[model samples]
Target: MGQKSGGYDLNLFANPPNCNFVCSVCHGVLKRPVRLTCSHIFCKNCILQWLARQKTCPCCRKQVKRRSLVYVNKLRKAIGRLEVKCKNAEAGCLATCPLAHRRRHQDSCPFEQMACPNDGCSMRVQRWALAEHRRYCQHSAQWHCPLGWLQ
Candidate 1:
C-alpha cells in the first residue's frame, strides 16, 4: 500500500476526499500540498517536478509558473486533524492516533517488527522485544554457549 503522509487510511473517512485533496500527478493523498494560481492543488514535489518539465498545470493545462505556488494551510491543517490507524495495524496494533502524530507513534510502536541483528538469524520480532531476542539469539556473536568450546 502507498504510504500516506498523514498515515490516514483514506477508506476510513466518512466522506472520502475528492479531487481537491488528491494530487493530479500521483493520484494519491497530497503531501505538503501547494495551490497554483489556477486554484488547483498538488503535492509540492509533484507540481515542482511537473513545472520543471512543463509550464502548464497538470489538471487544467493552464499556463502556470513555479513562483505562483502557495501553501494550502487550511487543507494542511484539516489533514493533520484526521484520525489514522497505526501503520502496524495488521501486525496487531490497535492504537489510533491523530494524523499529525501517527509517524511518531509508528516509529516506536511496540508492535512494529524488525529483523534480528544476529548475522545468521532470520527472526523478525516486534521492536519492543528485540532486546530480549538479542539476549537469547544463538546466531549472535555476543551469545556464548554454556560450554567453553562454543564461545
Candidate 2:
C-alpha cells in the first residue's frame, strides 16, 4: 500500500479491467481503492497525494477531505480476482495468475532472475538455467580434488 505508484500496469492484466477499476489519477488499475464523497473512486495513495496538494476530487472537482474517503473492500476483492501475466513473461514464463497470487507465483517461478554465485561473474540468469550457467562459468572452481575439495 506504500507503493509510490498507486496502481498496477493495465497491460499486465490478461484482459482489460472495467473502467471503474481504473484510477483517474495514476490511470492504472486501482490498488487499494478509496471512494470519495462525490462517488468517485481512486487508488488510496493517489487520492491521498491529491488531497495533499488540493482538497478537491480529481474527477468532478468536488470538495473532499481525507476523513471523507472510504475504503472499498468489494472493489479490492474483485480486482484481486483478475488475472495477470507473470512479470517474467518475456523470459519464457507462460504463467497467468490471479492478481492476489502474483507474488506467490513469482516466488516459485522457474524463470525468476538470480545472480551468478561465482565471484567476478556479473551475469544474471533464470533459476532454471543457473545450474547450467554455473557449470560453464569462467569464475567457478576449475576442478574437484579426489578428497572432494574444490581445487
Top candidate, metric lDDT: 2
Q: Which regions of candidate 1 fall more than 4 Å away from where they truly are?
A: 1-15, 115-123, 139-151
Which candidate has the top score in TM-score?
2
Q: Candidate 1, 61: how far from true, in Å?
A: 1.8
Candidate 2 residues 9-52, lDDT tens each?
Answer: 89899999999898989989999999998999999988898899
Per-model TM values vs. the true structure? 0.74, 0.86
Compared with the true structure, the alpha-carbon lDDT of candidate 1 equals 0.78
Model 2 scores a C-alpha lDDT of 0.90
Residue-level error in angstroms, candidate 1, position 99: 2.0
Model 2, position 18, has a per-residue lDDT of: 91
Q: After superposition, how far is residue 87 of candidate 1 from its true place, in Å?
A: 1.7
In terms of lDDT, the poorest run of 10 residues in model 2 is: 142-151
